[model samples]
Target: MSERQKPVLRVAIVGAGPAGIYAADLLLKAERPFQVSIDLFEQLPAPYGLVRYGVAPDHPRIKGIVNALRDVLDGGNIRFFGNVRFGTDITLDDLKRHYNAVIFTTGAIRDAELDIPGIELLGSFGASQFVSWYDGHPDVPRDWPLDHTSAAVIGNGNVALDVARMLAKHAEDLLPTEVPANVYDRLVASPITDVHIFGRRGPIQVRFTPLELRELGELRDVDIILDDADFGVDESDERSIATSKQLLVINRILTEWRSRETGRASRRIHLHFYSRPAEILGSDRVTGLRVERTAPDGEGGAHGTGEFREFPVDAVYRAVGYFGSPLDGVPFDDRRGVIPNRAGRAIDDEDERVHGVYASGWIKRGPVGLIGATKSDAMETVQALLGDQSEWWSPSEPDTDAIPRMLEARGIRYTTVQGWHRLDAHERALGEAQQRERVKVVPREEMVEISDPPATAQPT
Candidate 1:
């Protein structure tokens, strides 16, 4: 057959987040020997996974990433199958039968574990769960317990900052954002008055972005407290500050806040550097956090100083990091919480390539990097996938329509691209009525119902 008459290369990407969308975008744009057809499947009814569900509602700057991902999905070069799960709605064997290759980009959803005593206390929580609750993630419970007046957030990353800011910010301040009614209602009822953020390393070693660190001070009615002693920096820390611009800005901001007079804000956020969590104290619930002071080890790391201090707090949130959940048939490394892969190609227990299967983003590598970094990561995965086109699994008479047929036979109420557009319009309409940006639909059933196309219309 002529090159123009060759059958299209069908590819299925599981997960419609930035990572998966970027992979689809690259695959569609690549100069390949055959035309490519891409299908992006998402477990949620909505697209832009983390951008829509994980980002703090108040952070519009970061949420602006949705527009770029939207452009790719709106290009019509790819088909979006929302609300379709992999393990349940469809399986690996099903995907292989319909497409030439499959890519998994289900980014990490669970929080990384922090080994510490009393971590299972009643008041101890994972920052990821709190983030999801406040972000209006459909799967999480609508009501989050906020009885604690003081909370301790352990981590130095952006997520840690997000959790701290959310707990400390006045609910009225979040009104203009896309916070759902359920989340807003619960947040306003929170008795939280103080939120302490602890980092195991020095100020120069914090993983938070400069903007996020700056935003902590911008919260209304919240005073940022930094102990004068916590401001100590060694020669090596100073060297790191000079070398990394982010570190320099972050350190400068912290230093400036250290000199500021404490205001009578109703809420307070305490940023403590060089404090490592040794234990979460309390018999029934979190009443205090036992932390150990640390000093720079002069090798760009920290060493415990053997000085123990306990801060009385009602709740504890561990925001150390995130870890990937295992997919039904994917080869996962339990220790690393990532799919075993080499340059995006899935590897088996023997470390041999699992042809036709691949991974990208946090699942390919560990949960790290921002959205921009995720795009670059996708590029690498896509390049590797394209390079192995010669060895890709080709099903006899591959039919892209088979997967949808299977879902229909199973009675799965899947959401389509058009359905998403309708859902988007519905949200915008809701926001218009309320005179806000957009009011998110929190319940999964509501989202699926609203995003579902008319019964007369067939699934695309």
Candidate 2:
């Protein structure tokens, strides 16, 4: 941090997700003679996108990154501009007009569509939506229905397992967590007993981790039904594989299931392999789904065996993955399903650097990997932004704290970290009062209402 070393560059980072936060940290660490200031913007009033809204509630240790990131925000060099949205309130021109460079780290905000016939039915929803709903997303429906004897999650990834885990959790188990109070109440009310997770590929290709896979056995009263036929592994996979982590994990769970015969729970959580969802069958609402059986191609893939099976289910969740949104200023590639960039450098249609523009995280790489991956992804973008310091940070106007006024004018209510602290305290108090962990606010209105003061408190 020498005078000659401190580089004076003002950077605007869109989306306060891990990628954006990491990029801001890198810019500050550069410590060039020029001042490196980062203005981080988030569409939501709160920061920490997926870390707050995506990760499963039981995995609080994994979300410790939020506190680590809170340190980055408290560094004073990074100004948080929450409740402000890109592609709406302001355009890329407005940001480039003020800051030295703009980094778009807005992660894939939307989930991939299943595009099946009955997908649009009422009971069918994506796993992302379910996760967001239970995690207390302001945009999602508060009073959702899952009143059924059985549910089916259509995917074999970790996300699908998370959905099943949430559904299977004894109401008493979730009572100790930070899950929204209303979501817990609704989940407790759900009569669901069976949760079947389907995979087009065999267990060897399943994407869930060994620890997460083991968590399936911890459920109370939930019978983990398995078929020996589905456990068949390809012979070629044995030699071509580096390690048998996936098989070992699956076998461990299978072994545990076999050892225990009688004392398990009355509910069930079944893991089905080589079963592809061919169609969703429901009446005015979803009643069940049609599944097609498949056989291994011996090359670590599966081919439909032309046999079909149907299961009666009240709800269905597709947990495939997520994709990026098209920002007004950024060059998006539909083929790649992300913003067009060269090693985090935002590139134009003609394959040239779009000056003063960059991208990182899921929007740059397409939704994959854990929170650790965003650090490297963001470092690349920050390095590129540091390359050209002169093009940015020449302020045409003095700084104005417009966030408060803009929110007032647009009728957009928000929650400051202090306000969030207040809500947090209120929830914790409520949870303690009820002898539970913490009751979370389910709807946006309830959250905003708790964050803001009464109308009488405002100055006339």
Maximum-lDDT candidate: 1
List residue ranges in candidate 2 displaced over 4 A.
1-7, 240-247, 262-264, 390-395, 398-419, 432-437, 445-457
Candidate that would win on TM-score: 1
TM-scores for all candidates: the values are 0.97, 0.90
Q: Which stretches of candidate 1 lie over 4 Å from their true place?
A: 1-4, 454-460
For model 1, what is the alpha-carbon lDDT of residue 104? 95
Per-residue lDDT over 291-351 for candidate 2, one digit per residue giving the tens place of the 0 to 100 score: 8998888777889989999999888899888878889968999866788998888888999
Residue 33 error, candidate 2, Å: 3.6
Q: Candidate 1 clashing pairs?
A: none
TM-score of candidate 1 against the unseen true structure: 0.97
